[model samples]
Target: MTKTRLFHSNANGLIEHDHNRDGIDRRGFLKCMAWAGTGALCLIEGGVLKSFALGTRNASQVQSHEVAGRLTFVQISDSHMGFNKPANPDVIGTLKAAVDKINALPQRPEFILHTGDISHLSSPDEFDTVDQILTATHTPIFFVPGEHDVLNDDGKTFRERYAKNSKGAGWYSFDKNGVHFIGLVNVMNLKAGGLGTLGNEQLEWLRDDVKHLPSSTPIVVFAHIPLWTIYPEWGWGTEDSAQALSYVKRFGSVTVLNGHIHQTMQKVEGNVTFHTAFSTAFVQPAPGKADGPGPMKVPGDQLRSLLGITDVNYVQGRHALALVDASLA
Candidate 1:
């Protein structure tokens, strides 16, 4: 087997080298996880997906030229504020880094979509901190709750703070630039190690919500868990998502965005594209890569290279959204 050198930082600001080890120590592991999650930029133009790395380019160098018939947005997920674990000791710092990148983008996104896990324990202070940090972007944000956000009282605090107008556990929809955006709630009533769920009431609301929209209209769905099954064994996928998705299959263009697994994975079926974003706070092992899903530690130098952001753009008269993913390295 090929050997790899692993390095760690010491209190004296010195680097210590170690031989190949099966796992990283707590400090090094948390540092690695910190580098794993960032925001993303995506653009859809002329029915094509155009993606770019966020940290690779100087945001100031990006000119704000108005492209006719184009709509651009940023997606940031799994901030996990208030998380103080070995996998990531400074969740707030990493999240701030992501915000700085967003504010630096040449063309400001119309809005930002934060998929879930805004807080680790659903604490008011954590939510407040997230809001304060996100304020730097000066952009509106759309959100859905992750399992972590609803830890107490079925998301009472989260709903009060972020989603007051949301219906039936905070599922809602809106129209923007001819695109219909649907936000769903699946973290409620989760089974033990089972998938996320969209109850009967939410499904009924979803069907009626789209009944009046023309099939030609583009549709975007955001949730905390993958609507399509993506590793049921680890509870990464939603349980009754098929019923929820059946309502949008007839649309000409459909895109589903989610957060929860803390990594990027993409799939396409019929007229829909499903994608999951990386976390801003930590990294999780790939499906079946570890005993189960949790924080993943890597070489200190390789940490930032593994985490980054997703960017998406949409152009008028196009049937597809352009998507680009970038790493901080």
Candidate 2:
């Protein structure tokens, strides 16, 4: 097994984490992660969240409990379907591998969450190719766009196709087996390497949407960029997320899921659990790992091993939501 490398990010930069052989430290810092290209399964029980790694190297410990809950779902992001760079030439093949992993799960996910970057250049053909491949999962999927996905026409075509039910800029919310899920769009108005923002309209909508929910409701907020500040210099965090997060502050359990950094990250603040899923397309540099955040190259033999898919579960009686991450390798 490849030795797993765990990294922790603070306001300064990324640093290594001390961990046991299995590479898990549930008692460590609130901000932590096993490097990109790994996955996790998440389930919610009694308004709390818990997560376990599903790295292929540790399959023996996770295969059976992956979907152990009332609701099971998976999150796969940043497919970048038309990209052909050396960072990952066969983005298609690796994405297929992600689906294969989901199919092999003991219990299939009820649905899938795609955090965005579905296409490299926002071309119809690119979206078409991505759609063709994803249809194989045989599961429903919900999406919020990334900067790469909203190019050309300001996402008009993208919305018409995937988010007709969504209001302005494709933001919406839904409920599943008791959990309240909010899909947010913060990639709009993006400047080059600039922070993500949720304008006043969306913010108002968010505030109104959850104002009536009970404090015990489990809330899952998914978006394309990190709602919390991960690395401001690299535009890894959101600009108005503070306002967005305030809406759910009363909730007993809040789980925020996102992509766009193309890596895995997690943090706990008060009652909220914020997590970012790894990309299926290509890997990106860690905070300050390179001159800036973009694609990072890995040898072809090691690429598939690094691509990951996240599984999320919501368990009714346990008082927590559990998440496990698994890699295609």
Candidate 3:
């Protein structure tokens, strides 16, 4: 395995780059894109947030002991399994690489959380390929539908295969390790500029769902598009997320995970931390960095490094959770 450079956000609101054997000079790269492609490992415990790197330790050791005794899960987004373009011709191959990365982890994640875009086209074959490949991890999986996943049939197939237990539009919630996990579907009705929308029905369900939970419960909300405003011109945000977020604001710790942009970006608001994971299929330009959002073909040598996975851990009784991002390279 190649040494991975980890980028994290510190208390001072600055991103700290941990240099490693890769010698990629991340500071210079971050300067070029304003820190756009950097990934993060977020630790939120006791209502406080802290950041750390995956460091130069042995991969297995880092995986096994990074966040012992905490609730740990893996977040992978935008697999786009059927995509076959110059940006990435072997989507299945890369997806397998992601599975391999997870399987090699010393500590198996309790479950794999796939934010969205499991397929480029909502075809049976596409979904099947994704399902077959992901099974190798031997871990239960959770999903939220991305715009691409609902393209033709309004997510009819996606919901049938991956979200039967979910409610209208496949939105659902469950409890795990004392944490509340909510999977939301926002790609059903897109607003102007392609922004995501969580209809009133889903919003109401969300309100009632968390109404009974104690304020101390940690909430992990996953969706296809970002719940916060992130370059609305590009349709990177949700139109009614404010209403949804309003429901969880009283909670002490809320972590919102999303995928769609194909790169990593994070924001911290009062009690909410919004994070976007990278795509395993291909990379997309930074917000407004290109004319529009789509597959971006980078130098072949750099593709794997630009694509990666996010590992998240929450230590019991600790006031923080730890997240580590590792590249396929």
Candidate 4:
């Protein structure tokens, strides 16, 4: 098997390729492991994907920082279901582990926000597989488009499958527990190594969308692409993101969540907090660490240890939110 690394992205997760020395790549082969702690293990075998989980815990054990009874939800980014690579043959199995991790949370999220790229190739089977696994959870799933999900038929399938009640081509807003949630689409027109864009039409709608809300309202904005600068040379940042952020600047509490980079990173600017999630799929080289960002093929034994998820808790009046990134490693 030969090990070749390919890098891909979607709304809330990053997809990278891992190759075996024999010159072959399996889309999804996985395994489960335990080392006396609460973490899951994923691996590949015979070019087939397999996985298992350990130390399942209750989600409620995690505390809530809500000061004024703030509404809370879980954000799950990129899960490239149909993906098969040398990294792990069982991409779906790992994704299931992620969902299991989420379902096992002590506090069930109000809903699940899937940043984008729910499937690997925009294929029916891939989407179906993701849906079947996520269905195990009782929470509702909201989604935005990632570049990979729209590659086929101009995202017709993606829009139909995930954008139920979403306004104007997958951009929409909702009110939950006195908080405002805005979902934007920026990966549709992405260029190779270029920033993600939010066209004039979407901008206009966004302005009108939040026009009636009071500035005191807390806001949560999610999309597949990062709203802030994160290695623009690799197309990790957004083009019209500034315009979008400008509209939300008046709000006292603004939390921006995105996926696409495949790693967990956080940045705070003024009252706005930006967070990116890790890929349940595989790992990637850090920014500028390699000639270009792609799936960083590591030794098979270390693969599961490097993957995990993020837990976010916030209180209404609190100035700082606490985010815990649990790496599979």
Candidate 5:
């Protein structure tokens, strides 16, 4: 297999991804408008929120890095491509807009990490549509599954398309510039907007997967549900994540990422920092803000502004994770 490392560097942060071979060409670009000068899209302007319906702001400040000891990449989750709701009628449109934002960046990410929910209904067409849109970028894309992608069909199609190389029902790991990345599947049979579960077999494999790695190695675990409890009432966390996490507690630096909650919330416990990324599709109500978890209808103007992605970077020789969360609006 060809080995490729993709990284994006900006004046503010950096993201790097090392993955198996895949070639990206320019056709993946989705053109919405033509502009002559580089625009600086405002992520947060004076803390006054803006509408995401218009699309991503063209960023004026962007810088790519040379080969550096440390870098950054992005975490975009829950892109429900086929869903057409008032929250945003065109999720695929927004997803394409996100790709445009990434492609427009001065420094392309080494790769982009998508944490499941690639499709709303697990349809072959839905997956295909998402793939075609993401292919616009030269950056590589890696993925895990959300319950939505695995419902019915036993995740057969999802595994076939995204995680074929993954062992034991689609869970696997890879290394990039000394960082160990683990992608886990925990939403196979998720209840209606409920908790996430990782079966015993996968847990056993997880233990073995990290057994040989030194405790000093930095580890990043990406799944679809929160590995740490966010709100049990919403079924927003993973049931066996504690056991899965136990094996890696010895490691000095561990970052866990998930997307089921559909909002941005973060927590740091000891060496582990748990983050739930916002959805590229739409925002679900915050914990206890609504009756249950589902598509939340926001002002059309505010939707894209609320849609965002998280950027993470590992400092060389240390266990610290520097994070930047940027919104598409």
Candidate 6:
């Protein structure tokens, strides 16, 4: 079985819980872990993501400087701009709140990765508004398309607007500070229940993309849908991700990031860490917890608590990357 560590945000602080069941205690806190501990211990507060420093015992909050990472970036997914519904009457407000968190990071991220669903209905105005808000950060941004982004057209406009450097089906790769990052487009030709599909062409390109890199090089792959099967019954997984992952399985460290399920879920298998991010606009029912997956409405006061952002830090020379999910609340 794959080993996974999960921390859920609560009114008090982060709560380590059983992934199989939700038995969270609102007053509990994730036990403090030393900076150099075996696994990461994230403390969420004031929208800042930080790690406990060495020699520190138990603290609910600390400074980002306490974290050790040469490369740090932020991930915000499934914004669903222009979506004005009871589930989330103000998607723009929540999305902006998410950006505010990125801007508030004591250590501003080097860049931002918008996983997908940039627009609610692939409308030009929705795309324009998001672009305007994101530009305020004055940071380089990267993107991949969600199925919703390509509804009107088969990603032609999306490719021209956001993925000019991409290869077949809006897939692309780049390097930053010795780390290789790949932006994949699996939302195209989605199966029922939004199961993502990465055609053979993109898989071939991926195979050749990292063939020459030393296995020690860390790899970060971001897409709109989960590469690992989250809930195949709900179409929450990629149709042929096994073949795609096979290409990079030999690498010492591989981190796969995705956004479609609109919630945080993680799995560590061998050298791979598969993580799904929460949406900024709204939340969805946990896998199989509801009849299906869609916008899950909640009390207006509790919306932000369920929405959040993900911060990823890569500590150079350690082959280690830490990911923390913090709520906008």
lDDT of 1 by residue, 46-94 (tens): 3333332334352212213323236778888888898888777878877
Report the candidate with higher lDDT, 1 versus 6.
Answer: 6
Candidate 4 accuracy as TM-score: 0.78
- Compared with the true structure, all predictions reach lDDT values of 0.73, 0.77, 0.77, 0.68, 0.70, 0.77
Range of the 10 consecutive residues with the lowest summed lDDT in candidate 5: 28-37
lDDT of 3 by residue, 40-147 (tens): 344432333333334424334434565665678999999998899999999898999999989976578999999999988888899999999999999999999998
Please give each candidate's TM-score. Answer: 0.81, 0.85, 0.85, 0.78, 0.78, 0.84
- How far residue 176's Cα lies from its native spot in candidate 6, in Å, is 0.4
Better of 5 and 6 by lDDT: 6
lDDT of 6 at 161: 90
Please provide, for model 6 over 1-329, each residue's C-alpha lDDT reduced to its tens digit, 9 standing for 90 to 100. 35333345322224444342323211232332221112234433332233443224543233334344468898889999999989999998998898898887756789999999999999899999999988978899999999889998899988989999789889999999888999999988765555679988999999999999999999999999899888878888898899999999999879899999888877766667788887999888888889888789999888997788887877665544667676787
CA RMSD per model (angstroms): 10.7, 6.2, 6.9, 13.1, 11.6, 6.6
- TM-score: which is higher, 3 or 6? 3
**Candidate 5 ranges with C-alpha deviation above 4 Å:** 1-69, 189-194
- Candidate scoring better on TM-score of 4 and 5: 5
* Tens-digit lDDT string for candidate 4 (94-182): 78777777776655667888998788788888888888988997789888988778886888888899996777678998887677889
Can you give the lDDT of residue 268 in candidate 3? 53
Better of 1 and 3 by TM-score: 3
